[model samples]
Target: MNSTLTVSWRSVQLLRILVSGIFLVAGLNHLIEIEKTVSRIEAAQFKGFAAIFGNLELLVILSGIAMLIAGFSFMIGFKTRWAAIVLLAILIPISITIQVGQITTLGPLFKNIAIAGGLLFFILNDIKTIKKQKL
Candidate 1:
């Protein structure tokens, strides 16, 4: 058993924690400014199915809460795959409605896409780990 290998593994875990920390901060910010966030979502003109839930603001609020839950779960490494999936689900609509189009929004659009890619990478890595364990 190489001590260096053990150190490298620990370093990887630390990086994962750091990555999850970003989501934790984002989630907390959404929760702290929930009313403002919901207002912004409404301002974004999110219509259609979102309206079916009675009030769009409530749906937006719920989505923000979901993000917070997913972020917390990811930070704690609890059902990380499911957490990533939930985050991905939340990101898709946001990327489509808020981040897409407009030259001014392009940067955030790409950033969200990159974040989704990171989540996908985590998911694939988990699948690989499960497969290895079964073999």
Candidate 2:
């Protein structure tokens, strides 16, 4: 392999690790504090339909699982396009409905936004790969 190609691969690998680590930690943390997270969700005065989701923890768990799976796929560059799409589908709503309104207490909503952006990048990058795989 050319030196430039090796460097590019290394860069992608590092990005994958960073993205995957963030999702894994966030998911594991949610699972660990499922009750607390649910309570917080209940307290939020959301103006969207998500507030009607009574079993908030279930949603959180499902989203977390999606993130975990997507993150892993991203790290390995395996079916990354689909994984990124699923990850975005799960994350975008939470960011728009939940995190955006709580920025004062949440300090910053950039993390989720950054994740969403990263996932999009991965999806675009994997487009050719996905097509090659007939996915």
Candidate 3:
């Protein structure tokens, strides 16, 4: 491939690493700081959302596991689209529960939105690539 294409490809990989790193750290935080995470969730705008799962602590743990697995998968470019979808699924509710409604959380809310956009990149890019491959 040409230099520009090679650079572009490397940049894409770098972006994937950076994006997945957020989740990897967050997943570790969720597990390492379970009580803190739970406390924050409890303090969030959407208390009822956590209650829906019936066990807040368990939900946190499961979410952590999901994030860790999906994040690593995304970082390695394994099932990239599926990993992004999984991360996106986890992100939406968490973002809504924690960052929505509170004016103080505007930055975090937008940050999550930007992260969602990144994940969407993988999802859409893979779709296009897969279509091309099938031709």
Q: Highest TM-score, which number?
A: 3
Can you give the lDDT of residue 90 in candidate 1?
Answer: 76
lDDT of 1 at 93: 74
Worst 10 residues of 3 by lDDT: 126-135
Which window of 10 residues has the lowest lDDT sum in candidate 2?
126-135
Clashing residue pairs in candidate 3 are none
Best by lDDT: 3
When sorted by lDDT, best at the front, the candidate numbers are 3, 2, 1
Residue 106 displacement in candidate 2 (angstroms): 7.6
Backbone clash pairs for candidate 2 read none
Model 1 quality (TM-score) = 0.70
- Tell me the tens digit of each residue's lDDT in model 1 across 35-86: 7766665655443434455565565666768877887787676888898888
State the lDDT of candidate 2 residue by residue for 1-135, as single tens digits. 633211254556566677777777767777778887677666655635465654677887877777777768866878877877877777777667667778686644688878878887777664443222211
Off by over 4 Å in 3: 1-7, 127-135
RMSD of 3: 5.8
Which sections of candidate 1 miss by over 4 Å? 1-8, 45-54, 127-135
Residue 52 lDDT in model 2?
62
Off by over 4 Å in 2: 1-7, 52-54, 105-107, 127-135
